[model samples]
Target: MRASVTITGSLEDAFNEWTEGTARRLTDVTEQAASTMRDELRAAMSTAGLGKLGRALGHAGYPGGGNYSIHPAAEVFVRGRAASAAKWEGVIDAFNDGATIRSKRGWLAIPTKNCPKGSRGRFLTPDQVAERFGPLRSIAAGKSVLLFADVIAGKSGGVRKATAGRIAQGRESKLTLMFVLVKDATIRKRLDLDAVIRQWETRFPAMIADVLKDG
Candidate 1:
């Protein structure tokens, strides 16, 4: 995603000072927008129940082992000596953005093809899935299908374990809460671009004054 901020105001002398300062301050201003996007996206992912991946998101790294980037989207520009514009970029902000295929009967894996460009699947590792749904008690796993039984209550608050019974491997258990398809607009709502712009506008004058004072 990309967001552009354009500053508009009367061309008075005082305002000219601010606009000139804004042109020079484009980098810092765009950085602030990026910062806002980062924070907002993190919160949105958490709310969308993808907090694990969100925690791994970064600004300056290749996407692998859950690490992703949300760097600057485009170049900053000063248009006609009257407006200053900057674009902020984002990726990995979608919940239902990619496709995946199961590697095994239980393990959900990223397919080798038919995936969105620059996208990675958020499937758990085999070990993780085993941990959540205990490892097969049977020695022959591939011989038959497997399913998790209900959590049997432990006696006297002790830890529960598989009871001495035949675990009939007939069908595979489905992961109910595997992935959530949160809408793009739902994630965008948290960005609150208007608030970000308003904040920048509210502080631009003071920022320009400080620059002038220092100059």
Candidate 2:
């Protein structure tokens, strides 16, 4: 969002000084606008049910987690300063604008309903899954379908661990499906960061006027 300050009568002198980049109060106005932008961004994230991710804006210690800085030019954005910055940056971008996430590796293992979450309420990783439940064998369930992988159909056999329990009696528990390996996954756009920016853009002129008026 860009703040265009138009000076008419009483503020013409201040605007002229601002054009030459000599107006000291213009810095104050920029700071106020940037602060409002940061707050609105956090509010927007919270409204989109991304409170945890938004909290990272305040956590400068995190990889790519720095908020806003006061400068003559108003700016609010995430800066990648760490090794894992790209990973964390994608988190914000995915939520801001809808994204299609493809695996960097051969396949991306997505957790199924049968998959268990970790202690931190996050889905278990592939290594964690392997640790908890022995190992998971790979079976190309023909074409692109995870649902068919569990049920017997063609040359592709279902992934199952046969237990000692008698299946002849027909009271044995069904096998568990841990994950669905896919090439890519789609994430719908949920955050309106642009909307917040637009809102601040309109209010920026007034903010500048107040600062110049006070001076």
Candidate 3:
């Protein structure tokens, strides 16, 4: 997925006029602006809690004069991501466009607090859980779920994963809720990518001036 900001129309003409009769090149200034916008977008992604996706941004363009036609009249563009970094695009798009996720197969297995964590403390997947305790015992409810043990082990609330030694010894053990089966899940529109682009878009001309001034 990608979002971009482009300078066109009077903006392009104004930049050309600003750089008239000088050693400054449009390509150089545009590259600087694109780089600056990429950095700003990356930072905003972090601020919006989409830091991983934010770092995926890549800016490209600013070819020679004749290349303008191929580039849609913009010297450069701040692109959100590339194909190599496409894994996190869905997440970014979901936050930007808002989404309702439904299971493509059957039920969505959402990890519960009682679910066992991996060595890194991340929640284990269904296959990993199955490796630990074989096929999960299903419980009958509105949305059916698979549990570690048939009976809800004697505990306060949440499900538990019984230890290997306890199960072998035939002793009562803690059983935690592994997963909650749900039909769908919702992601709200939290990140406004267009707003971010516009914010930096306004600063582009100033960036060009700054580059020329420094040069």
What local distance difference test score does each model get? 0.39, 0.63, 0.64
Most lDDT-accurate candidate: 3
For 68-90, candidate 1 gives per-residue lDDT tens digits of 22221322121222221111123
Model 1: residues with Cα > 4 Å off, grouped in runs: 1-24, 60-94, 104-144, 148-152, 155-158, 162-215
Off by over 4 Å in 3: 1-25, 60-84, 116-122, 143-164, 167-172, 205-215
Q: Look at candidate 2 and tell me the lDDT of residue 136.
A: 58
In model 3, the Cα lDDT at residue 189 comes to 90
Ordered by lDDT, highest first, the candidates read: 3, 2, 1
4 Cα displacement, candidate 3 (Å):
52
Give me the overall lDDT of model 1: 0.39
User: Could you tell which candidate, 1 or 3, scores higher by lDDT?
Assistant: 3
Q: Mind giving the per-residue lDDT tens digits that candidate 3 earns over 36-83? A: 777776776788787866766777654545343212213323244466
